[model samples]
Target: MASKQQTVASFVETAPPGELSNVVADIKALAPSEAQALAPAYKKYNEEQYITVKLPDGNGTAILSPYNSLDNNRYFDTATETSFEVDHASQKTSNPQPHALETPHADLLRNLHKALTTTSSEHFPTSSHTITPTNTDPSTLTILLVATKFSPQNFWNARWRSTYTYNPSTTTLAGSVKVDVHYYEDGNVRMNTRKEFASREVSGGAEAVGREIAKLENKFQEDLNRGFGVLGEGCFKSLRRQLPVTRQRMEWEKFQGYRLGQDIGGGRAK
Candidate 1:
């Protein structure tokens, strides 16, 4: 009779002899090529003590570690992987069967990705732009944007990130777009808003829908740029200052002098 197996609390914990033996057996069962493919992941997990295992399918990527709650007691990662494919427009053809209504939104995503990434503006260069299709009923798409000042000397390190979720309009129904924005400088601020567009806006074709959505995104980004500047100069300036009114670092040793005569020695010196 075979000995019973043991389970560790999480992947971070060392596998017991029984579990280790079983893992070894699983590895051995794979074909030679497949076993060879596992070498890199094994080495990475062994050395770094953590690893994110990307699914072979393009749908998403997974993190296999204790941090992920789904894998707390199992060797396999059960948590859903939510990922966006950067510039997914070019790879859209890979989908065997796409919904009839997705084409216009695909165009919108592609246009947004192109316009943002191809700009030469030094103010905020495009860092990343990605799109993920949310296959829920009344299909929708999510677009993520990241723009940053790419200079090493720029201490402020200004960054603008936004997420836009688009709901396509049917023949009789108007559609809506929801946007969430995060702008970072000395401090960060966030804004969320939604807008509805008439069905006529997207009625022309894919190109029309793409153009309309791109226009809305550009306007929203510009508004946030102005808003963030105002906030940094007015409200956030004091919080970011390095020195007090003396224009120098506080002298902790001298601070005790003020407390020499008070209870807890916090008053002026006698």
Candidate 2:
């Protein structure tokens, strides 16, 4: 047996089983009591302070502690938000920014003229002139000009009429043109011209008129494009027939009325 007690090695000595188990149990047991004692103290300390109460959605409100008993909460609503700030001294309030001027009737008229002159395959036959508003009110502007003439005969046989409606509310512009043509046996033509009555109400009020004018002006260009396309097709059809180009020339001439010449042969040549 002595010989069999060969060398046995142990890395370290171990305490008897359960020797310090009671001490470990005591430490574990003290942790809960310590935590409980600290809980009340923490509650008491925080009771006198202001705190931010957070909601599940992450929005929070300031709240006074129970011990402090002060009205620390402040809430803001849309109507009472920063945008509603008022200057008491100046008796003024803030409002959202307004939109910039986007459309103008003058611009639209120019575009329509350009489209009619170029796309209709006619030299700048149409002329436009501006009529200033007699009143100081900028909203009361008027434009007067003779429409294009389609035939040379329009010089002798033409009658002209103009009608329009102006609305200060919506800044809208609309109107129509009607032309009558008469041809003589001697290769001459005449035009009787009339404009349809139209009007628009500017929806955004007086302050918005300028902007609406701008919008209408842009739309005017689009309308001119469409109008010219149709007019071009019709003119092309007539040209194909090789009929007396009298009526067409007369209508073009009507547009040149007042602008081109004082009398038939006395006017400036195109």
Best by TM-score: 1
Provide the clashing-pair count of each candidate structure: 4, 34
lDDT score of model 2? 0.33
Query: For model 2, what is the alpha-carbon lDDT of residue 148?
Result: 32
State the weakest 10-residue window (summed lDDT) of model 1: 86-95
> What tens-digit string does per-residue lDDT give for candidate 1 at 5-109?
211112212322113234445544643334434433343332222223334355543333222211112222222323212111111112122223233455654
Q: Please list all clashing residue pairs in model 1, or write none if there are none.
A: 258-267, 259-265, 259-266, 259-267
lDDT (Cα, 0-100) at 163 in candidate 2: 20
Report the number of the highest-lDDT candidate: 1
Q: Over 4 Å off in model 2, which ranges?
A: 1-124, 134-139, 150-165, 174-180, 186-195, 201-270
lDDT of 2 by residue, 1-270 (tens): 422111110100111111123322443365533332332232322222112222223332222133112122212111111112222112222332222222244343343334333322332244322222223344544332223333433323221222223333355645443334445555544433443445666554333433443354445446656865886788756676453323333344465554444344455767
Give me the runs in candidate 1 sitting further than 4 Å from their true place: 1-200, 238-254, 257-270
